[model samples]
Target chain A: MSVKIEASEGGRPHNEILGFGLIGSLVCIYLTYLNVLTGTEIFSFFGGLGAVIALAWGSDTIKHLCSYGLGTGVPSAGMIAFGSGVIAMLFATKFGIAAPVAALVIAALLGAVIGYVSDKVVSMNIPVMVISLIELAIVGALTMMGLAAMAGGSFMFADLVAGSTTVFGIEIASYGSSVIGGSVLAVIFILGSIAVQHPFNACLGPGEQQDRTLMLAAECGFLSMIGVAVISFAFIGFGSAVVALLVSIIGWAYTYMEYIKLSRRDAYDWLDAKPIHEPKGGA
Target chain B: MENLVLGIGITALAGALATVAGAAEDTESDIGSQGDPNSQVQLAPQMGYIHRIYNKAVSGEPPAYGLWCALGAGIAWALMSIQINAVLAIVLGSAIAVFVQGVYATTAYLGRTASLAKFEQPVYIDIIKSVTTVTMAHAFVAIFTTVAMCQLMIVALGHPFPLPLLALVWGIALGAAGSATGNPFYGKERQYQEQKFGAGVPISASGNIVRYAEAGQRSSLDNGWFASKLGGPASGICFGLIVFLELWRTVLFEQIGAGWGAIIAGVVLILVFMVIDRYIETWARKTYGPYVAETEEAAS
Candidate 1:
């Protein structure tokens, strides 16, 4: 719900969107903790395209603070930056303080104390808004621990207590799939929360551009790399799930052919295919 | 405020369902044969959690009251702790709560007569008829009535609300049941819309409305202004592959005879997923053609 275009046209510069979100979250937390410490899943589809280039720099700072109007502040600050970046990246990678720290700096310091108590306690001003809610909860806890370590390869904590903890009634199966990290990690935590909040809430308006909202935020990060290559092919195989479904159908045919060349410079497609010139006294 | 933070999070979920209803019958007979009909199942995300609470309740939100009152007190403590058959979990949980409360009461009575993101284009053909009636009402319902109401309240409401109070009662009951079925299509009396596309409502000769004057901008291949129509990303990936093959046909879901080959491979995968989603929406309108094809041939 943008009002102030100010000057829009496929905009970008802001230090190339925070240098591609702090160098794409330290290169997808070093190719997802180097395939969860050398065990490997073939550079896990570039760690879900480096957490979709760190949620296209926290959805281009939610298209520059919902283009200043802030109608439903870009999905209530991306649902409180993915609910405090998936509860501080699952309690700093399952309690044991992420094996001597660095669950993306404890989900970017718990998304800078829930974006400073929602911009100083529930006001939700937004602006730099605690570093775009700690870069959309440290790229949504590094794209949910790089798509739950590329479909349960290993994000550790004994492979999330053998693929998705159960405890008392016990499940902890390890690689031999107990619904591989339980119900495909609850369907990639609800399809990575709708591929990190439907690419800037369906590319906002004045036909909000920014290279067609970072090429529809890399076509919602290649539809979360076809939902982490079809739910991490229930423990990555079939040639790394046919190379993460041919790198998400060739990254959704090169970002939908540059989003049909930026929806042909829309004024809702030239005020409905250029005709109405209603001027003199027609007002 | 958000209904006083959803009435103190549904009265601390009715005091954690009266303190986990006295440790439900030996954890419902230790996950009672993972919802019986013995083993090897595939899918049952109860029509993918009612097509993700009617596509996040008409995209904006509201509904998901403390995760459907902790999935109605975790389906009465996961059918008395998974001993299952509370009349087959209330006849598949009242047929998945009367098929997601009759697809959220027919998209809250066609969003008070056609209003998905405030109507437009042949009233966005009735807002793509509530996203093709929530992607063909989850492939004509029966996503195995949510695999024993999600393995009887997420494996017997897992010793009382783990997974961050079950992701904050499934994201505050999917935003309080999509804001009580989108509060009777709030602020009604629209009379054909497109209010300057995404509101900021300006243009006027008494603001359009000779049946909402002329219009344009529709058909989006990539989440343009909320899924640029033309089978919005092939019916949101055919309602997420009919709730990921109805919970991947209940995991270890074996079966040879009697099962008519998993009902003829789920009727040939819903007739090749409606012929590859109407051949990828007529090859994405004959290869990336419409961002408003010459404003629909200069509006007829």
Candidate 2:
């Protein structure tokens, strides 16, 4: 089996693909928001799960960076990504509610600052750490917003505050930014983290292949979608949950089949070979 | 037929759970939003929260001791609330502790690792790659298990355990479990490190620290890499208890009680952790025959 994953083994540049996924998710988020605005909620279902495809882009970045043989190993990169992602996501949701565009800007800025510290102050020597983290934070924020949108039907500030405010004896501030935040969002955040981090982690080796890892990322993304659906179910967002569930199930089946096929193609001759033909009777 | 029945049953159950969650949301949705201009006060702070926190973190040229005191005080304040908000403690409070403690613990891990001890001038990538990654792994386990246990508490009992107590009890116990099991991942990470860096870590199948003598290269025998197999989890449990208990006691304890709690909890955690730690140590020694940690070359 191929253990080492070369930087060149990837089919496309990590940044280029990350850009595509980012733009794609933004477009999906915008369209979904528009749909939510006009009262045709039909399009909203695709927003959350589709946006996380950007995470596949993030996974690609992980494969590229970690392949250089990060001395600590790969999972740290994943943790850092998720760590930065979570903080960026929280900040995004806080502001994204008022002016949705603000969330993206805030996330990018937060990521840039963090990247700056990681590079200049920390002196990691890996110049790309900052930019990578910046992108990770931005994409992470977007994914979280996408999830909030799916859970609450709109990431509009008012909706979330309304949803999360726990009224105890008519006290005004039971919790701030409690809206768009729930056990459901908690589940999505954790699961989304796994999706963004797991594929590259599982596939890493000297023989690691880009395509296989990407497929693994796709499989993980689908599983995360399923997790989102279950959380949506918990909150009784039946329509959204069902839509997400159905899409994830179909997508998972397809990706899993492709993954299995890739495994077969990439396997040792013995494992890949058809069963040995046996003589039925004494010839 | 049996598979079909099981599938149908699970689907129904899932649907039922979704409906239940939806009902909960519906109840909340019933409340009217207070989105008037007065709510603007509430909204303004949310926007500037990041900026304010940022300024506090970086802008001050304060006394070093003062900052350290503030840090401890701040953590103590957060831990006090663990009783009322377990979820928040584990999520937000534990997060801060894990990041800081993860850094410290991982640094200690690197320092204690016989192979890595000689290396000078640690950089961000090296620190990030191993320390943060290892810390994240253990913390991830702690967090995931804490969440799972919380879920179980909810399902088995009608109400969830108080957040502070839960954080303390599970923070240490699950931290121990994590220390015992999945936490030694970094010890095995040398193969990758050797592959990438190629300084001095050569595999000597006979389990000796392979030395690198070539100019412009550093190498160490691979034999001692396994020294931290038990150390990984030991440190994990040790730090987990120390940090979690510090938070728990600070917020919950009386003046005299704090001392007793510290001594008692510290002792108990050590004793319990050591038993488990020794088991894993024995397990490793038995599995991989006793190996030497010394290198042929002088320590860097």
Per-residue lDDT value at B222 in model 1: 15
- Score chain A of each prediction against the true chain A by TM-score and list the results: 0.39, 0.80
- The DockQ of each candidate is 0.03, 0.02
Error of 2 at A223 (Å): 0.6
lDDT of 2 by residue, B1-300 (tens): 563444334334433332222221111111100001112211222222100000000001111111111222222223332223444433443344344333323222221121111121111223224234443443433443343333333333222333223433433343233323322332223312333332333533212211222342221112113323433334444444543444333223323474576466556667887899899999988887554445633463
Every candidate's fraction of true contacts kept comes to 0.00, 0.00
Best by DockQ: 1
Residue A280 lDDT in candidate 1:
31
lDDT of 1 by residue, B39-101 (tens): 110011111100011122212332122222222323322233234545465343334333332
Q: What is the Cα-based TM-score of model 2?
A: 0.53
Task: Return the lDDT, model 2, position A11.
Answer: 71
Model 1 ranges off by over 4 Å = A1-15, A18-24, A27-53, A56-58, A61-142, A146-180, A184-186, A189-199, A207-283, B1-260, B265-300
**lDDT at B170, model 2:** 37
TM-score of 1: 0.30
